[model samples]
Target: MAKKWDLFEGYLKCDPNIKAAEVVTDYVENYRSQAISEEVQPIIDRLEKAKADYFNSLFDLYEKEAEYMRIDRKVKDIAGVNYYIKPVVDFSDINLINEPEIVGAQVLTTRLFPTAVKREKYSYEEGAKA
Candidate 1:
């Protein structure tokens, strides 16, 4: 890390356009500015990049959503005749005691993908609902 700072300092000093000596006079001043800049600049750059990426990703998602909805509608139309999407809850992995009562009461449902076996039996010969 120090070596990186040294290399950057050397580069700045060698640059004819910059007044590197004014900014980096003493060891403490040089070390502090470099450390501060090193820590801060990357974070700022990362946040900027992330913001831009987020908007781009959002645009991508928006473009795909209409197609996805169309496909989903087709699937629901086909599979939804005999079966409706059922919500299942599993508390096996959860630390129920540590969590709030309201949290346990909240229901999470899978409306998109079916992950259930219907209790009612469907038979072609019988043509029954049971």
Candidate 2:
């Protein structure tokens, strides 16, 4: 990871155009600003990149949610029914007596997708009264 920072530093130093060098230098500076250790710049930059990527992914997901809701239930049911509506479900009767280690949780997270099960609307008058 240090190699990446070294490379970026070298690029900033060697570039003839001050503007280009400044951009790289600024990015390097911003990316590494949080780290007090000079040697940790690469790690910081990698983390910053990861943070940006993660945020963008979350943002893109929010933008995609509109289309996800518009899709009909029949299709979702076949894909595993109503899975999307409550996709990534979890319920547990178990309890931890103490703070758990990393290995404690055995829960699984499902991909966000709609459920396919057709929920029949209950009508008292139409059924029993009729």
Candidate 3:
């Protein structure tokens, strides 16, 4: 009868977090148990630093992935800018104003950046009815 290597190997593979975590606990215990010179213990310290560097690299990758989703380049010249800034929600921003009631509502109030929208849409101090 042939032995199934894949089935046996499946039990051995562990999650990186579980594996790294377990290795860390074991490393600490092993280091503590060994008879050693005071100077030799720094090797264990190096392992901790290397483990930290590995996780830091993983974090840096995730941040880059998030940043890549944004509109990357800003138009330098004002005249060169265009409608809704081409999908960028800039208040000085252009956005999908998603009030379902206002979805089809015309932007009767679009004023490009630097070009002021002409209206007295608000009173600096409107008093309530007494």
lDDT values, one for every candidate? 0.52, 0.48, 0.42
lDDT by residue for model 3 (10-124), tens: 3368533345555556546653344243324444665587669866965675576456435434333332555333323222342322443233333334523222334333221
Q: Which residue pairs clash in candidate 3?
A: 90-93, 90-94
| Model 3 residue 22 CA deviation in Å | 37
Which wins on TM-score, candidate 1 or candidate 2?
1
Q: Which candidate, 1 or 3, would have the higher TM-score against the true structure?
A: 1
Worst 10 residues of 1 by lDDT: 106-115
Predicted model with the maximum TM-score: 1
TM per prediction:
0.35, 0.30, 0.26
Q: Cα RMSD (Å) per model? A: 20.9, 21.7, 26.4
Q: lDDT score, residue 26, model 3?
A: 53
lDDT (tens digit, per residue) of candidate 1 on 45-123: 7559867996696567556665476666676688887866322222343333233322343322323322233345333
Query: Model 2, residue 98: what's the lDDT?
Result: 30
Query: Among these predicted structures, which one has the highest lDDT?
Result: 1
